[model samples]
Target: MAERSDFSFLDEAEATCRLAMDPAATGIDLCLILERDALLPAVESIDAAGFFIEDVAVLDVAEGYQARYHFRRFDTKGRIELRVTAPHDDPHIPSIANIFQGAEWHERESMDFYGVTFDGNPNPARLLLPEDATIKPLEKDEKSRKSYLDLMPEFTIVECAEGHPIEELAAKRQAEREEAERKAAEEAKKAEEEAKKAAEEEAAKQSEEAGEAG
Candidate 1:
């Protein structure tokens, strides 16, 4: 796990998670899940550490809307995701556009999709969605998100291992294949036995006919 020397200023906030660094794949090293109030302080520390805001995205989960602030440094390799959850009733958080100009567009897009109000976002214009659309399509569980199979091919998160969520659908598929092979082998053995019985009966009848003729 790559340590963030700058995070010490945040007073050991409990929501931090250390993920193994994978620069080649995703380039993410750390994930800090923070409350709305801790958002500014955490980002301040990140900025001091020389990280720049990459993008801001929003996701609607069972708990509420999740605002994800993606950050990375040009001089450094790994990326960090700073996440904050807002209640379903009132999803809002302070905007970081003032700190990083790139966050301005991202915040607007997130607000457009998930109805997360960025408190100080300057424009807050609808980037992609229709202006008249009142419903946040992303917030509706069925509308915007795809199933696990669609996203990961065939994996479902059933448990966790070594601090990562483990998908067990592959194991379930292997069991199904084993069961099918077992049934096929049993049927083949049964057919072989029936053929042997028929051959033996034929031999016995032929011998009885020969003896009667003699």
Candidate 2:
């Protein structure tokens, strides 16, 4: 269980996109769903916090192309995930290679597999696929794609400083989960009461029969 204040450096970054998540559930302490423009400042703040960039990954979903940046610190117990989405038609995200040089190859790998453009990358060349390849082999078709929220159902957005587009959806999903749990509990209590009543009736019947026989 990590608090927002645990990562104080985020105050200098985008606080509105900050989310405190359950580390036990997601294996991530904090998550930030940042806009394209806010990505660089967030990364800079993480670096200032003594966190190193572990990996940069891209996911093709119904919403768009999601770029995930994983960060971790040796002395800390928490891991942070920074997410930025780009439209499917315009899959362009600002490159973090300038801040973390190691991110250059990771971003290039993403470009090769998902056709994502890492703008400002010193060298935007394919790492795995052929240079002449035009198709992104890892991209999913429209029918097979899943929304970002759908894939990350375990993440509950507890706080949002500024209203975000996905805040409403997260709230709705949380409400639905609570309602389902409430209904299941009610059903269990009702079943228990019914079973208790049936047992009482059976005992009364047997006692009356025994009294009449005596």
Candidate 3:
């Protein structure tokens, strides 16, 4: 039988949510719910505790997107889940790419399919979607979406120790998202221009060939 993990330290650290371990039901040792800003720090804590990143997964819920990070310890027989939700309008989370190099592709795949932005990821380009795909294939319909705030309104949102408003962080993230959009637009424009140039050149070559035949 797998031993139950001692996750009391997370409670002391003031985690947003501390669900007891149920390896049988959840197939994991612990579940720690973290506020957006606290995610990076909590992940660093877990890394320091000798856990390795297993996979980054996301779910499209009514409230928004839930980002679930699975971690496991190779030396020990233990695993844990770190989960956080991002609002649909501004679905952004700090990327763990720096901590786990393999997370780059995982984050990209999530971004391509769910439109969730993993902030701080060195490369945020589409991983699986066609260059022209604007819609996230995995996004849920409006009628089915659930409100994450409604689901857990009682939980306190963690803020910076300096008392920075969550709104400020949200705004900063929104700005980053806007910047990424602008860059994508520019790249798209460049591609269009190149395509037009190529088409014109091909047409001219065809015309020259016809003239030679005449």
Candidate 4:
């Protein structure tokens, strides 16, 4: 039978300590960090196992995927992390922000920066970006195209600037308009000169006709 030990929440430094305790934990390993959407399922798994889960956060990756949900609990003398792998395309998991208030900003930050949609988050907007600002919708294709309507309407919005931002796009269009106007002006000036020349020739021909008739 498994041992029954009390569990505690791990602090930031303690989390690092737990990582150092493990040799196979490469690059600051903290066991498994589940996605926010998978938080409930993960806790259910642990609860079913009779294990305790304490805290949760959005795993921060410097260069790789960041939408990964990271949760942990302090076991006997060590910390065990809870993690889940979200689907690559349309990758979304359940949100546990309801259970843990701390997950609010963590989930918001993840959705804001990484662009992952949480199912039951209180606020899922880009917390880092300005409220009205829209730079990184966080849900763009590989090429940065905004098509992220995958998140539900009721879920919290953690605004990352503003999604579908067209400020730069509008500027580009303005520049194009100015260029077209300049071209049109040039064409009009040329046409005016040609018309003036035709009028002068017509007047000269009329004078010659009058001289001949006289």
TM for every model, in the order presented, reads 0.59, 0.90, 0.64, 0.39
Among all candidates shown, the one with the greatest lDDT: 2
lDDT of 2: 0.86
The top-ranked prediction according to TM-score is: 2
The sequence of per-residue lDDT tens digits that candidate 3 reaches over residues 59-148 is: 888757899899887666667778888988899989999988878999999999999999999988889998778999889898877654
Off by over 4 Å in 1: 1-26, 142-214
Cα-based lDDT at residue 97, candidate 4: 73
lDDT of each: 0.69, 0.86, 0.76, 0.49
**In what order do the candidates fall by TM-score, top score first?**
2, 3, 1, 4
User: What global local distance difference test value does model 3 have?
Assistant: 0.76
Deviation in Å, model 2, residue 152 alpha carbon: 1.7
Ranking by lDDT: 2, 3, 1, 4
Report lDDT (Cα) of residue 111, candidate 4: 68
Candidate 1 residue lDDT tens string, 55-117: 888777655777878887666456777778788788889998888888998988888888889
**Residue 8 in model 3: shift from native, Å?**
5.3
lDDT of 2 at 43: 91
Runs of candidate 3 exceeding 4 Å displacement: 1-14, 146-214
